[model samples]
Target: MKLGVVGLGSMGYGIAASLLRAGHEVCGADVNCEAVERLRTEGAMSEEIVTAAPDLHALVIVVLNSAQTESVLFSENGLAPKLTPGAVVICCVTVPPDFARAMAARCGAFGVHFLDAPISGGSVKAAQGKLSIMASGTAQAFEAARPMLDATAETVFKLGDSAGTGSAMKAVNQMLAGTHIAAMAEAITFGMTQGISPDTFLQVIPDCAGTSWMLENRAPHVVAGDYTPHSAVDIWPKDLGIVLDAARASKFSAPLTATALQQFIAASGMGLGREDDAAVTKVYARNAGLTLPGEE
Candidate 1:
């Protein structure tokens, strides 16, 4: 299959690599020329995404937010219009449910199929082609997208036969994921104040009842004091903000989510926006006058 992938960041690049390994002809685009070039060396198509759009059987959008997703599909010279009738747009970006529904309607007008398919399992799983996709769309959309889906996902949950359901599920996921990461940072730093080293906290927690996937996954970064971003601190603000907005719309109280958002905001304010999200511990450390591993 011929596919186009927009936004070749960590997860996007991994998805593109997986598609290439699956023997698909992949054309990748990114504002980062190096990412595009990097994927090209690994056998992705070198053609410009715009020039290749007309022939693409599917397009996977892994951009950061809904705005970029909209621009990719609906902006002037957007790829949606350029795609042949019956092509599928697999949107992996997390977005509002209403916005997903709206984009589906707009794409339908152009005779394109839109799948609200937000993904999880992070960059590692994406590169391994083991991602979990929470997807919803018309049956026809699923059929049109199956090839790329098979190439990219290990588990594909069919949520509903419409666009909004998938985004709704993604919102739920981000809410817990953001909250857990913040909670993990808080607990690890709080332990530090009691003279429990980050390394000791990591060693003991994963076996405990209180441990979570986020805690196990991110705590190693804190222990090693490595802030290099596999996922950045700034992402939580936008993602958790999305969760809070959706919560507010439903009259849901998300105090934990709100508190987590503030911690990420403070981390961003401390010039750690581009650092690994585990660096949220720094916010707590600063408030308590404690130093993290590398800083010490």
Candidate 2:
């Protein structure tokens, strides 16, 4: 398959690499010249995606938000108009359901099939070609995107045959994901206040019923004092914001999601936005006047 991947960030770069490994002809584009160059060295090409747009069977868009996704597909120099009919667009960003529907409608007008596909499983799984994709779209869209999906995902849940269903599922996942991370941060720091070191918490908690997947995954980052981002602190504000937006539209109250959003917001406001989301523990640490592993 001939594919184009826009946004060579952590997740995007991994998806492109996986596609290349699967013996596809892959082209990558990113605002980050260094990331683009790195992909080029790995047998991915960067020769003007627009020129190859018509020939591409799939374009996997892994940009950050709905706005960037829209700009990449429909704005000046966007590729939607250039792509040949029957081409599939695999949109892997976290976005609202309504936004996904709008993109699907727009792509339909151009004779392109849009997959409302949002991915999970973090950078490690992304690099391993083991990510989970929550996807919904027309049967034609599924048929068009199957090769790329096979290359990039270990688990592809066919949630529905429509645009918004996939995004709605992703929003539900993000609500749980974000809340779990925040809860892990809270618990780890509360342990510190009780004279339990992080190492002790890690060593013992995984054996306990209180342990969660997020705790197991993120607690090690705290133990090592590494704030390097697998998922950055800034992402929650966007994802949880999407959840809250949808909640408001449905007239549903979500106090827990709202609370989790505030903790992430506080983490970002404390200049940790670009750091790993595990830094949400820093908010708890600051409040209790205790230090994490690497701090003085």
Model 2 — TM-score against the truth?
Answer: 0.99
Q: Put down candidate 1 lDDT per residue, 121-177, tens digits, no spaces.
A: 988999999999999999999999998889889999999999999999998999999
Name the regions of candidate 2 deviating beyond 4 angstroms.
none
Q: Which candidate achieves the best lDDT against the true structure?
A: 2
lDDT against the true structure, each candidate: 0.93, 0.95
Misplaced by over 4 Å in model 1 are none
Counting clashing residue pairs in each candidate, in order, gives 0, 0
